[model samples]
Target chain A: MAETPIRFGILGCAHIAQTVSRAICLSPNSTLYAVGSRSFEKAKKFSEANGFPPSAKIYGSYEALLDDPDVDVVYVPLPTSLHLRWVVLAAEKKKHVLLEKPVALNVAELDEMIKACEVNGVQFMDGTMWMHHPRTTKMEEIIYDPERFGNIKTVHSIFSYGGGDDFLRNNIRVKPDLDGLGALGDAGWYCIRAILWAAEYELPKTVTALREPVLNEAGVILACGSSLQWEDGKTATFHCSFLANLAMDITVLGTTGTLHVHDFVIPHEENTASFLAAAKTGYWELVTGMSAIPSQHVITTDLPQEVYMVTEFSRLVKSIKDGGSKPEGKWPSISRKTQLVVDAVKASIENGFEPVQVRV
Target chain B: MAETPIRFGILGCAHIAQTVSRAICLSPNSTLYAVGSRSFEKAKKFSEANGFPPSAKIYGSYEALLDDPDVDVVYVPLPTSLHLRWVVLAAEKKKHVLLEKPVALNVAELDEMIKACEVNGVQFMDGTMWMHHPRTTKMEEIIYDPERFGNIKTVHSIFSYGGGDDFLRNNIRVKPDLDGLGALGDAGWYCIRAILWAAEYELPKTVTALREPVLNEAGVILACGSSLQWEDGKTATFHCSFLANLAMDITVLGTTGTLHVHDFVIPHEENTASFLAAAKTGYWELVTGMSAIPSQHVITTDLPQEVYMVTEFSRLVKSIKDGGSKPEGKWPSISRKTQLVVDAVKASIENGFEPVQVRV
Candidate 1:
């Protein structure tokens, strides 16, 4: 018997939603069934432009879309401020949630949203597309290999982009009441996630923000960085900015090996991604040169990373819908851990760059 | 008329001397004229094993080598504890000094060495070979190009090696009375120099050591890191360790571009080096991919970087010897700046990781 495809209802038409809509349509187990905006005209316009099939529903209000029993899941790409309201409402209406990152304004709000999903028996997953990339899994295997890489030592990550004058002045990412967290939530989130990923998801004991963070007039972070320390002597640092050139870097140093990836956030090519790894790197007899040059490991996939994200989410949602299985806990657990570190970094910055203890 | 080569006298035969001796022999303008050691047997053995010419003089004592009037330049590879005494003595003896890095135990000692060279009209140059690599010059041009790289934002560097148990127990770098500063001085020197080079040699305003540095029983740093902030908000962070795998990385982020190099300290290959440069990197229409992928810039050279260092140092020495030119102040000035940042990091660590103000 063939399994039924999960039907997705998208809430609002954020810029990111366009990409997610495409991913949903592309995924084998997911179909873009509906889209809802504040008005019927906007929803129809979005659905027409985004290649939604004629059978896809267009709703004037989000409530109407959530009320559709055919919509098994809702991909919420709303701004951070509105996540709590829409995500909880969608969960209460029995729709699984795939929420955008900077998952909430803070952990407290994220906790409430998680609770609502839990109470409604709905699956929750954040949209960190890179997590689904095959290259990430390959990097994980290499870094955690007991012989090749040994125990982790340090990690450094940077995720930044030149947003230019218009973005700095006008984007929702810069508006205090909308995205609010600005570069820290938008870009630094990826860096923090990379560091945590390198550390195998162990929350750091403390996080200390670096000095001289660039903040806009509305007190939103434009650029910032922080150093994290684990109890076992592992250390990590990350920087994120809206002012620097576009960069996505992750450098992980272990006892016996190193891993470097320049485009961890977004692959330069759609079908291929790569990371450089070196094991037991040493110098020549006279220390004139290195004995081992890092070799590149390329991973290829037919589908884009976003489609993978959608397919995985739909799998979890389908298992719960048809197989009588409980929602997968791993997705929300990782999301919570990432948010904890983000909150600690924010606290460190707010406390005049003092070290903030990270409580699990 | 052809120019006469600058005559080079070797100091006590440290392990590094073998490489520099080869470099001296390879440089067209530098000749290995004499060898010196505490014992004549050691000097003779080093010279013979290192392929010195039969006519090269072997001295039983360092003083005898310093007394040789034909020794135009003295290459000092002795331990840090012996640098102040031997470097000053060589300078006073009118031999141009090509000293190894971590230039002195402290700036006070370095100041005395510099003063001696100034008084004796001898050239002073530190043996940081990578500075002479043509790739370094090319990188400098790119980073300083305002249109391509724009204003510098942040720099991160790492130089570390897994020194194993034997090295941790017995290496001079781990000994309190010998190298004293341990990994901080040995590996951290290159990281600091890279940051300064990226910043065009402007010393940072403040340096704060990161927490939980791994130290030996003698309280010498085995692994450590620090963040430096310049007056203009240009920030840099560096980590150096004897506890991690060999890694030499430099990542510089500017408003418009980025530069990345993995093997900045020692090239993976002797004759060629490369760096990745990305200018105006942006995302695709839907932010699924990069619009401009970073391109690798491979640089090749006929002579090894060490040979270039020797050639450059000898060229300056020859100008002083033949053209009656005053010693170039650039080399000593940059070495001093690097030492200043090193001192500040040490102070910050000693003061329980408090921020230490850097003085010019």
Candidate 2:
């Protein structure tokens, strides 16, 4: 019997949808089945521009696309303000969700989205592409090695990119209504997730926002940082900004090992990823030099990270449909944990940079 | 017609003195003239093991080394508690002082040391070797380049090393009476200095110690971190530990550039040092990847860093002796500022992790 590919429906013709649209076409387990935008012309243009197959359908309204029985999964790339409406509607229509982040404006909205997916018995996942990359798993192996890595001590992550004059002036991310969380939601989301991931999904006990985050005239965060403390004395710090040069990095320190990756959010190449690792390193006589230099580990993948993300989401959807497996709760749980930390950081920032307890 | 080398006296036979003694010999304008310890036989063994010249004088006590008029400069590598008494004696005896890090227990003690050097008209410089390396000047070029580096936004540094079970129990760094600041003084001194160096020696406005710094049973810091914020919105964070792998790194992020060095405290190699630098970087279209990778800049130094440090100290001493120039105040000032920030961080930790305003 031929294996059936999960069909994808994309809501909105967002700029991110262009990349994910290509990913949908590239993923072996998923098909670019339908696209919906307020203007049918925009959906058609997006499909044609991004190599959508001729069999792919287009609709003027998201409702039409979600109503299609063939859209086994919906990838919603709508603005934060519109997520609650469209994501809940997609769930009610019995479609699995592969949602783009923020995930929502706050935890309350995210809870609703998760609840809707739960009630509909559909898989839910955030569009955090890096998590699905093979290199991540490879790095995880090094981090968890007891003899080499030992117990975790500290982790630091950053995701900052230069936004030109035009972006600072005109981008929706700089506006309060469209993407209200600003850099905290856009770039900081990845930094928080990376810290949480390095800590093995253990939520931090406290989150304190670093002082004086840069904000736009509309009060949207342009740059911010936070320090998180765990119950076990492990510590993590993260920074995110749209004002600095493009830099995405994570440094994980353990009792005996240290790991560094310069591009964790987006690999420099489509096929290969690299990270620097050092285990049991010591200084030379007189502390003039290191006993051994850190070695770089490169990982090659058959598929790009975006495609990998789509494939993973599709695989989860297929498990429920064909394998009689329940919807995977891990994905939504990760997203929720990430959102809860984000809320704590934002709260810390709002509350005069006081350390806020992470309640989740 | 010939330049006279700065004569040197060793104040104690500490482990670090073995390295600095060799550096004094290697430095062109310095001579290691005297060695001293309470146990004359121990001092004699150290001098023999570390290749002290046959002409070098050995003394039964540190006061004998300081009292020797031929000893133009005294290099003090004693534990923190002994620094005030011995260094003050050396300075008062009209000998220039080249002291080890954690120059004193606090800023107040550091001020006394600095004042002794000032009143006695003797050059005062702490033995922070990396600052005098040629590679430091080369990296400084990139950091100060407005076209490339722009305004510094953030600086993150770490200097951590592991201690074996026996060393953890016995090393001076872990002992409250011997080196009261523990890791905060040993490793954190370099971390704080790196932050200050990257910030062009400007003291931060506030220092907030990160929560839950690991302390030993003797109430000495084993691992700790702190965040500093400057008035100009630039921020920095550093972590120092005796409980983690050997990792000395500095990550400086600017508006238009980023600089990364895995070995800021001590390079992985002796003669060659490298740093990763990227200027005006951006993401590739659709955020698929970075437009350019950070290039590695290798700097070759003919002299080792410790040798450079010694040569610089000797040159300052020579300028005062030969050219009748006043002692340079820059080095002592840098030490004072570093100690001030260190005091603030320690105060914050002791005061239940409150944000402490840097008095400087």
Candidate 3:
């Protein structure tokens, strides 16, 4: 008996496409059958350099690639502004989609994509690969289990970096129309996604934001804060900046203790410690041993990006083949909630940081 | 040879006055010579109970006590509404003053008090006692020393608690006219003071704030954030909350490591840990074998409150006796900068969280 592999097509030869291409090639249950770019020459060059089968089709237009009946699932790694168009088109072709982060420019586009997938009887999953990591799973279990981490009271997270001039010159991340929220749409979504995933995809009730717009640039928010409230009466906050030096840290405070994770988005090989303080006397005793590590975890992989993307794509393929939902699939809920947070942040920036309640 | 004792008088028997009274009685070079309350019976009772000498006077009116030539200093712990009037009157009477926190209702009042003290050639100090503690000196030294703490990047601090019903029911902290900014004027001042003091009183260029009015029952701000810029081209942020459960934590981040100071405001026997990461490995290591000392230094004596108050009052007396500026004195600078931060927070709140540029 031989195992059958799901056929995958790559749309848009963007840098992110390399991630999906490698994942599809490496997964035993998936195959990269075809690829499409705005230029046929570029598509052919990428396929040949990446060791694609000679039978793998190359198309100059995305629609031409979508016309292939053999392409089972389409991986859309286009710019943020083009996600809705390609996702809906892929669904119309009776194909499932693995859309990149900032799934769409706003909730309306996401809603349309969701409806398209439902009407076509196809699956739609946002490409939030961090959610698939083993460490993320461990963190979620610890944070949600009352006996392990206790009831969460507050969450503080930051993701920031200084995008050098060469990187910002011609990148879609700096474009107002394509990227919409700029750094927020580019990298902040991961931080927002991390919070939502940890909170079990609970939509927050209110979001307050403050943005320092990049000078001489319109629709580019350099820094922002999104304060979120869940229906279960839990609150969370996400802070992000693009004009500052790099930083990625997430801290979750519960009634009994706090869990601090560093570099949450990119699982770096680092050690983290949790500090617990229950009573006044206990607090003093704990402070004395604060520098001692009770536990430490290490990741030795230099390919976290490929590892996360492959795990999520493999799960998506298995779900389609079995005619069942993906394992712990919270993509739709997470996507919708992330869109709410993004919209609230924009509204807050426009209103001078007066908190905007998220209706969703 | 005997040390000359400074004569002191208190105008009210407020809650804070109790702390000052105890300090006066314990200082070796200070004497509580008189006390004045609106009710004669209350003044007489307090004087007798506190063991004032037979020569000590009890007055039914504050005006009579101020007229006493024997009194060299006065402590004013009245309601926020009466701070300006009494501080000015005390200064006019040629008495040095130790005015309680929230120096005045607004910056204008603070300015008036500063001017009155200057014109009368009398010393006036805002009783921001946290700066007097040894821990403050240690924190400043650690944060500013690049070799020890590296480049300061971020700061987050919180102060909150639950108060007595009566304290919230009829106190000026609940009234807009007297308490002004409410919780912000009362408990929130400590948080603002800590951040400004840690930043060495470098005013921020722009501040953005968000106030949740529903959370403040007694004219208090439930939560607020102020984005600040230092003269050294660094950005800092301060957050405060009164409605949440008790929490006082301050975390300072630098390039090489992070200093996490638990229980920042009233750090009673709490401890802090430093986590460092080298540039090459980018691996964070918890520096071990560190002793857990009290988060704050205890200036203990037979009477702790008295010892704390006298520590500052005596400094002022010695400065006057020397007829020159005290090199060790930080009261003037700390008080002025604290008032500046308080004023900025108030202006940000009033203008609907508009960025208020701090002047000097």
**Candidate number of the best TM-score:** 1
Worst 10 residues of 2 chain A by lDDT: A283-292
**Tens digits of per-residue lDDT for model 2 on A1-360?**
768888998898989998898888899888888999999999999888988889899999999999999999999988887888888999999999999988988999999999999999999999999999999999999998888799999999989988879999998788888889999999999999999999999999999998879998889999999999999989999989998887899999999999999999999888899999999998777878887579999999877799999998898889899888999999999999999999999999999989999998
**lDDT tens per residue, model 3, B1-360:** 986788889897775666567667777878889999998889888787775788888999899999998788888877777888988898898888888877777777777877777777677776665555455665676667777555655555655443335656666666776766666666667777777665666666666554433345444554555655555545555555443434555656554434555455544432322222222113222211112211322333243333455656766766775566533335555666766777787677778766788866
**Between prediction 1 and prediction 2, which has the larger lDDT?**
1
Model 1: per-residue Cα lDDT over B74-112, one tens digit each: 999888889999999999999999999888878899999
Poorest stretch of ten by lDDT in candidate 1 chain A: A284-293
Q: List the residue pairs that clash in candidate 2.
A: none
Model 3 chain A — which ten-residue stretch has the worst lDDT? A279-288
Report per-prediction Cα RMSD to one decimal: 1.0, 1.3, 7.5
lDDT of 3 at A269: 37
Identify the superior model by lDDT, candidate 2 or candidate 3.
Answer: 2
Fnat of the models, one by one? 0.83, 0.79, 0.00
TM-score of 2: 0.98
Identify the superior model by DockQ, candidate 1 or candidate 3.
1
Candidate 3, residues A206-287, lDDT tens digits: the string is 8776535342256576555566655554566666655444456676655443455655665443222222233111222312
Residue A73 miss distance in model 3 (angstroms): 5.0
